[model samples]
Target: MQLMHKGSALVTDQDIGENPSVIEHAKRMGLRLITFGPHCNAQVREMGFHNGNLQIGMGSLRLGISLQSDGHHMALNAQAALAALHALGYAPAQVQASLAHWQPMIGAGQPQLLPSGICLLDHSLSNHLLSMTAAFSQLQSVAPHVSRRLIVLAGIQPGQASIDAAQLALEPLVRDAQARRVLLYGEPLRPLAAALGDLLHVNWYDDLNQLICSLLRTTHKGDTVLLAGRATTNLALAADAIRDSFSGHGGHLIASIQAPCFDPHQKQMNMHS
Candidate 1:
């Protein structure tokens, strides 16, 4: 609201509840409102994506913009950018062409290939479940050759009303990713680790440094690591630690550890001590 001025345009998606309120507020302030999404009534609408490209159909005008990043969320974010551009009176063709050069910054689902051949998807900047799901989807698309996928979850806020419901919601995401082992860090995620229980191989960690070092020492080549957390958790530090490990002596140390991180007979590794 602070960003808006007289004759300015408000651009947003249909999912935001602030839309109607913002529209009324815009009208009072003489601000133009523009919305774009799957089910929004606006000048720009009909937005969707396939593979890594975003498609927007505004009436008879169609624009297909290639995304430099991964996931469904990126497509929506790009569509919102396009809508914002539309509100700003930019040509659709110009916006489409310009967006081709856009790339996601670190910690926003950007895939990083360490020198040790571990593909790390750092999504620690975000805490939402939807974003985590998108990160898993990204893994399926980008690292098909990954022999083992290890999830280094800083935390997860399920937002569900009950433990069973939250477990039901989270179970499939882990299973679908085919994660060989799950390493969870921080106190906020104890319920998350508990929810997974014995159904999936899960390890709980209180010491962030230990978790980082353990994964570094155990994970091998052809392994993909998905790091998910929020800013408050300082999960980005963990991502950095993993990246730094490979560039230094830690890389040599990982090569010497056993091939797989988990024992075939063990379902969970408790590192609370």
Candidate 2:
């Protein structure tokens, strides 16, 4: 890609691996390059939950990046944009100030509190592991004092690889969150259930109705529920069922839907893909 200005470029290590030639090309073109990863300049200095949002402290800012789950990738994108802006004669403070009004799009870690004091982490819209992990961590941090934690995992696609990926992604949460119970819907859960065995209170269901029934029956007040996974087909139905199931209950619901991006030039938001 040709640059209009000789600006600095920030590329994550993962991105570099995916497009090393592009990085090399950019470097050769005289762009100052900054790489971020486990050992790089884009270290997440500090991370915590504040006012029901995730706050990441980096660089010189004591009150660092504060955003919702939807802003996870956008945070990194913002960093790159900041680098470009700084190279184009904008002050660091000016760039930061411009982002003050930015907000997370829908389905990007949007939390909804139900009537029963139950909080829902709705990440059902997308199934990217990194974003899901960030959302889970944010919820875990914010609701540490909740009475119980529940996970409603959608069924993965039919394949050993899909099952394996789901297992790997969920193992940490199951162990760390100390989840009181888990309601898994779909065929991909069989192996996972077998693997978890007695370690977790897992309830597997092939039918969506049964799964929702069990979820409603088991959930109680002061509990946190995380609804996630890659159920591409029945996501909308499941969301509606859950909403109706918890209608009178005094709990909270956080439905993660794909939110639109705001186009500053157009002064409007673009639809989620």
Distance from true location, Cα of 84 in model 1, Å: 1.7
RMSD of candidates 1 onward, in order: 5.6, 11.6
lDDT by residue (1-273, candidate 1, tens digit) is 566688877777765624567667777888776777777464566567777777788878887888787776677777788888887778888878767777888899878888878788899886666777888887777667545788887755556555335434555787677677788777666666766776446777766655766777667787888888766777787787778776555555445433434445423346332
Angstrom error of the Cα, residue 107, model 1: value is 0.9
In model 1, how large is the Cα lDDT of residue 246?
A: 66
Candidate 1: 10-residue stretch with minimal lDDT = 259-268
Q: Best-fitting candidate, measured by lDDT?
A: 1
Tell me the deviation in Å of residue 68 in model 1.
0.6
